[model samples]
Target: MSEKIYVPISPPTLLESDPRANLSDVERALYEEVLKHFSDSEYQIPGIEEKGRLTEAEKFWLSYECLLRYLRAVKWKSAAAAITRLESTLKWRREYGIEDIVSASHVEPEAVTGKQVLFGYDTRGRPALYLFPSRQNTDEPTRQIQMTVWMLERTIDLMGPGIETLALLINYGDKAGNPSLGVARTVLNILQDHYPERLGAALILNVPFLLNAFYKLINPFIDPVSREKMKFNPEPVKDGLFTGDMLMSEWWGGDQNFEYIHEKYWPALVGSCEARRASWLEKWRALGGKVGLKEWEYKDIDTPQVVDTKAADAKAVVDSEKISDVLTTESRVPTLAAA
Candidate 1:
């Protein structure tokens, strides 16, 4: 089987104080207070000189759900803290020129050996991202990090309405050493700081002593709250996020026999992603083509208005050796639907 249907996503993790989530009066109040902070035009950061406002484009990318993520990350208090982090991310996005990496040639070389692969989905239909340190094909830290961002952005773009996270699988196969503490810390910082509350889980496999020690050194850089989501040397099936068939086979572990051939996998992966972005952009433009639009709206997926604070709700293996199918059916709109 090339693909299997999965359950809708559960209420994404850690949504404590959002009306759109568990719809308690307390949650409604908290949601409003956070909104109030950004809803005002005169909002100001205590220590910053720039306006504490997100540009329309930035707001579009941040989405209402994303703001709630930062709020939940801070335990539903400290609107100031959440906004501060949001502002920092906006600044970083500008300085980083992240959009350029979408089609960047510099990052292409790193992915040539299929070091990073985005394929399939977990039990709740969260996109699965696989990393193989053993497949390391590059030595440049900067471009390596850019490739990480590219992969992440693609993952997010592939998320369905009820899904907001990714199932991260890191398989450090034989003799594939660990990243420098500096590189690891920088990547962790990006995930924790800019991409708050977005990791559904991190399943690490084949951890060597060196990699284990490397984790110890980077512990401080990881947020304690998010740290709990990391599972070391986990049984993917028993851990409950993935089924064997859905998991990548071979060095990664699972039922399917799959191998990554860069040429075929790359184009299929990029084509699928571009198709998704095209669909999203079309819907986004229909909805005023501006920011402040609810993600669930342009996302054009069913979601609850008021909730019980509960839950919610990919494929392609081209051949035996390629990924003809990358984005799962849920992630990509059919041409007719997109139109």
Candidate 2:
């Protein structure tokens, strides 16, 4: 059988999964309190006031999953601790201008060499992000790090109800594209602080002696949990992490000939993610709009609800109106909810 494939979302693997799952009664109560806190507060960004008015994207950002991720980061220990980290990330996002400059065009140059390709998925349907440091095209650390952050954000966009993490494939060929220790630390800090639990695995390949030494230098910066996720010289296909067609071809791999032509791959990836987000936003809006909404509701929202037009026509309510015409399934896209 083929391993599970994913694009943005490939439907939730489980019905009773999170935004908040595996919580004790107390932890569940704490989640509710955190929700209340988010609801009652107004988070102000640099140029935008996220108080009474919230755009779709803003609403999307302050989503139920986003909060739960932070709480999970702190191991559901203290609501205050989770809140502190959450607030810090919000501040960093403002300073980092997540809404303003982190876009396809802004990070386009860094991606031209196809150094970091966001392609494929693990067996759990988590998006696979492959890094080829040898192809690093820019010397500017800021843009480079921005590109990293941008990719991380893109992976989040690609996650689904039961899927909240990404598979990181690092191919440090000749260690040429390896970043400085300072840059590595900054990236690691950002991942642990802002992203927490979002890294499903970091499959490292082609570890030269220098690269192994380099990992030692930055090992302390990596949290124990993340370090646990890292595996050197992984055999993904053999281990069943990925199936043949889905893994990156020619390397660290199964059989996907994932050639990264920036012009083609970049636009497709961004556009597809945008479409997935729009689909999710539309579904969320139909249910009275919520930063309060649970992620699993997507599964609930997609439950089959067929309308009987014949029965409607027999009733006295607008008898002549063609409800069937407006409610046909002819134009519906094949959504993950159906899977």
Candidate 3:
């Protein structure tokens, strides 16, 4: 009998030794393709105006953002996997010039890892808001604030006529002593008083003030051509609505120009969510919240009566033909005998 060989399992740690440990072959190939396209000499920041002078702290944070963006796109499985790819990806690593920083060396894992994302898509399956920003000014902090407002407005719209939800996302980076903050607080107070029947959940994402400078520096790399393509020129929904070809075309067109760093990898995740929506909704209702279809809410309501003038005209023409012979004794006797 041959001796059995035992494989050793690695212990969990904050740092991983190998950079390629996290990468699947396909993912590694995709990473290389993306970097090859984006890392050309033309992509370099030319001057201080486009890419501002970076301090040591700013350099560290920007590199962290870049690594997380790539890892997030890949959907890594574990902490070790996430860190390993973060170190090996030359596109991001070259910017920072170092590998993963152990959480223990800096701060506790809970401090950074425990923080939740600020705003998520709501229960109604619509985004809370559409953050449409002017291409002229592309500040990340500003864009984040705009997205926050969009989320709040969308929530209120979905909640129905009289109901409201209390929510706000503030960027503390903007004008520290500004009076607008007080105005925002007052508005929320008024809304809370108006919608006493519903529970309000407030979400706040407080990004560090250093982010203002970060966006300013990275503006040159923001892909201007893509932004131009994404501009919305509204058309009547009735023109091309619900055409399968149109939907797929629009999806494909938008996909080629720009990629949302956070949302690109969510389609597969959402497919799983769709599979579980029915059960998840039932569990949500069991927790004491109301669950009913939008159509159900309007069941008793009557739609406006529609009279077709052409149909009425056709009926009048048939009546004028005077078909009384069909109802006469001769026609009726023959019809009855055949029956």
Candidate 4:
């Protein structure tokens, strides 16, 4: 049986040049403007900047790419809004101990249930993250959330240049341990708000009848853009969007005999993470020193609206049956089955 390996590949040449080249004229201009704004010392996130852990070179690389990601997330419309969001994320990272997460060497034992794993890349070269909810071993909501975030961060770091997005394959094979609506909502909020434009596609596989009903109840809250990107059990391998040879035999109709072995996979992932970190540090040391955001600036923006859980639950109950019908109808959409 052939096995797939995950490692960081070289970034695209375009990124090596001016990262702005990847954007449109309008977007490029906005990216540059935002970059300049963040370069200023006055614009620093209070406690984060004060730490002074990041070297000058690291700051430059971070400011350049980070600002671009923020702009891309908001579609480059509002500079003030993007800045506000970026600053908020920096603050959140500080509170969340994201730095420690990246540096950690071992996978959380509870998180390694042979359920969620990073597979090969998609046709677009975006990494594919597979999740088997039925294999979930723990009901601790916080740990689940943490594992989700950890996987997301690792996937993001593994991204190659020109491939900022990712593909998610959620296998609801029995639908026995599906996360609750509240958990789903929290994950959605994190992705929509913090990781903008990061999801290229979400392919839900082996969805049971009951799970389809749940999808229906929760579908309304999902943004239209996100809804458009979602596919319910697509045949990418058959359609040639993905090569069957590259997929594990357990899923996607491939022939390769692949099974999740936690003991083996976890150590490989740790090594990959360490190597990637070293590569990033080397690159930062070489180029990070020359770049710096001299002065900082600040802007005022309103906080995002909070979700009403009570109203959401009531609505879900009211629309449960209706959602089944909606899913049945939507299943006929040609693109949904086409990868």
- Each candidate structure's TM-score, on Cα atoms with residue i matched to residue i, is 0.77, 0.80, 0.20, 0.74
Compared with the true structure, the alpha-carbon lDDT of candidate 4 equals 0.58
Residue lDDT tens for model 4, 28-59: 67776766766666455656746634434236
The candidate that achieves the highest lDDT relative to the unseen native structure:
2
Better of 3 and 4 by lDDT: 4
lDDT per residue for candidate 2 within 1-339, as digits (tens), equals 332222222322322133246678888787888767666545443343444344456556666677778888898888888778876776677668787788778999998988887765565556788889989878899899999999888777666555678889988775564579989999988998888878888898898888888899899889999999888898887776664545665676564444566655665567756676677777788976756676556524343222233432233121112211111121222332222
Q: Considering TM-score, where higher is better, how would the candidates rank from best to worst?
A: 2, 1, 4, 3
Model 4 CA deviation exceeding 4 Å by range:
1-25, 46-63, 101-107, 289-339
Taken over the whole model, the C-alpha lDDT of each candidate is 0.65, 0.67, 0.27, 0.58
Which ranges in model 3 have alpha carbons more than 4 Å from their true place? Answer: 1-120, 123-154, 159-182, 197-199, 207-296, 299-339
Clashes per candidate (backbone, < 3 Å): 10, 1, 1, 13
Q: Write the per-residue lDDT of candidate 1 for residues 1-339, one digit (tens) a residue.
A: 445322111112211123445546665566666667665666643444565455555656766687777777777666677777777787777667776534546578888887888766665656788898988877889888989998898788767665677889888876787888788888988988888878987888888888888888888888886688888887776555565656666655665555666655665566656676677777877887654456666666433222222332132121212212233334442321222
TM-score of 2: 0.80
Q: For candidate 2, list the clashing residue pairs, or say none.
A: 133-177
| Candidate whose TM-score is highest | 2
- Pairs that collide in candidate 3 are 129-150
RMSD of each: 6.8, 11.2, 27.8, 14.1
